[model samples]
Target: MSDLATCLNGDLLCTEDATRLEEEEDDDEDDRFVFLMSRSAASDSEEYIRFLFSRERSFGDFGHAGGGDSLMRARSAAVRWILQARIRLRFSLQCAYVSVTYLDRFLLRRTIDSNQPWIMDLLSLACLSLAAKMEEIKVPPLPQFPAKNNYHGKSVLRMELLVLNTLEWRMSQATPFVFLGFFAYKLAGELASKELLRRAVDFIFAAIEGTNLVDFRPSAVAAAAIFAASGSPPTEKSMNQGMPIIESPELDQILSCYEIMIQAGASPGVGVKRKRLHLSNGSDL
Candidate 1:
């Protein structure tokens, strides 16, 4: 093994005192996170939509997988930090996704210091902090992160700055959440229930645990999540009904992503669980 990979094969998976963060919020927080996007989408021309997908394509060319298993575990560990924060803080899943988007983009461009596993913990916390500032209705203070002896304020600030600079200060990430509503409506109509959207969100959070989803564009991942949530393959007519609903050229890609999510998210004697996610289509559910 390379020095980088060898340094990572230790017990840095998680800290023991994970659930100590005490945060409380009301049911009303969900209202603030409704999908404010236009379902008609008349405002977005085809060119603009294509531009969004193209940008995702450009952003997803992760060319830094030289470290094999240890590196993959490191990445997964960092994302789990975000998940732990989300569960403890009861923040919007959008916040979690934004954190992950920044983490993925940052890791794509910057190398983690192999000797400093705690740096992954700090980076994960910093990414979550940045995303909460962006998406949470009430951002929590960094003190809520259950910091160890080493996580000082200045260190976190430095790490946050490093993440911003690494991503060139561009934070308008096009995550799969951006396309969940549009793709679900386009492909499934009313069949895409409140229950279905909930499952899709679970699939997304579960599927994004590691690099299994690295190659997919956000839209493709969104479509695949919809399929995985439906708990069955899309019908031939449903899949072929229109312009961008998993067109023939991209059907295989969506299918491949679907299998990945099922494998990545499956549990024994149980299906995917629902998270606190809801997608509104400017109409009644």
Candidate 2:
């Protein structure tokens, strides 16, 4: 099985396991959960972080000479539209994330004429369709996709082929969602209810809408989302309360990324001030 599948199905506790684990002794379960968090944290080394950064860099057109602002606006608009459509269709958050990744990467490499705005919609359709296929178990047929956008099935297919080629068939690129389950588990431990994780995932989706957040690594974003969702102040007591403290290197990295999100005006207001305090103290947590 793919790493994502393994993480989602086994390490992160599928539905059955979650229900079963709830019945286990609290202390024993907390110990086991701590062990899993340690293992996950240990695996996320500097090299691993660099690898994710490099992979993200490989996608998305960060630098385009002239008309860059306009391009970003168009891209942002398309992303918003795609996200709304995904919600309407009841697609998974993963599908929206992957589709945006594909769309940005495609736009980075392939320039679209600003006058031909309809092509952007077509591209969004193609990317979203491909993402749905990748992440959804019961993907709607291409013909059945919403027609309000006026995308023809044949054109979408052609764009999909082009995107597949451009990405070198790498549809399973690492995304923030990939790290969410692990981080959420680390933050809440056995107490990490599905609702908490869902809120964190929701924050992630919200963060993705910010074009300024494009440069941050997915792992960092995942960590920040968890931090924001936990409602735990970044202070020493808050950070260490109810769970194992997030140690240095990792803690610093997540704080830096979270600050960036805050500066971009993208973070939820729940823990923003407390995070600033934690940053000021440089406390280990």
Candidate 3:
């Protein structure tokens, strides 16, 4: 054998040091740290964290890998459903969007059988509570997630702690929907008749609802919402192409969603009857 081999076989080398190094490597491999870790382990964890936050998953695009359907179409349908259903009160669309975002983040770490729909409700409530806490200082202490058979506020309160823990306290406050609402009104313009403006808002709400389906780019949702609310009937050909493209397919889908909103009694109505606020200033009067 070579001279080095001969030295290693003879007791001329530090065998104890080699054995100790091997033992140390094995120990590191076997360690199960909760959070704290050695340098190598910490590096691995940091890589994982980076992966988690890397690409923001959009629910509108979730099912694209599974079929021929475009991501935009599914998202469009979902947005329509949310707006039509009126799932949350006040700016609930904003709540829904934030909740959906949280659900997307959670799903990256945990996979669920897509067949189980109740998980959607759980995630939705978790998002709502998180957003509410962030949005309102005097928010309801706990979420009021509705029960299957009862509307007891107590039942929703009981589940609050569990939901909070599951979310790990990451609740986003801003949503594209809220911003889109203002944009839609502005685009309809002061010159537009009241009926025209109201119709535009109705369509915009439908587009906002569309965001719920497939993973859609928020910008595209904004465009689709605007297109739908523009007081123009969307053609079926446009809807097929889907939002951001503004083709026939997309227009069709928007129109269909609008029809669904109307059938579901979600069409925007005349502003709530309100006594006109009388300012002390007599400039207008």
Q: Assess candidate 2 and give its lDDT.
A: 0.57
- C-alpha TM-score for every candidate: 0.74, 0.62, 0.42
- Model 3 misplaced regions, further than 4 Å: 1-93, 104-110, 114-118, 149-174, 178-201, 204-214, 233-266, 269-285
* Top-lDDT structure, candidate number: 1
1 or 3, greater by lDDT: 1
Cα lDDT tens digits, model 1, 67-177, are: 557667887877776766675687776787788877777667656765566767777888888888887778766666654323556667777887787778877667776
What are the per-residue Cα lDDT tens digits for candidate 2 across 6-106?
A: 22222211123111101111222222322343345434554555566577557554443234766678777788777666655666556778888888777
> By descending TM-score, how would the candidates be arranged?
1, 2, 3
Residue pairs in candidate 2 whose N, alpha carbon or C atoms collide under 3 angstroms: none
Scored by Cα lDDT, where does model 3 land? 0.36
RMSD of each: 5.9, 14.3, 22.5
| Deviation in Å, model 1, residue 179 alpha carbon | 1.0
Query: After best superposition, candidate 3 residue 275: deviation in angstroms?
Result: 12
* lDDT of candidate 3 over 103-207, digit per residue (tens): 444444334343433333333444455555555444443322331122233333333444455446544423333233333433443332323323433443433
Name the lDDT value of residue 77 in candidate 1.
78
| Shift of residue 101 alpha carbon in model 2, Å | 0.9
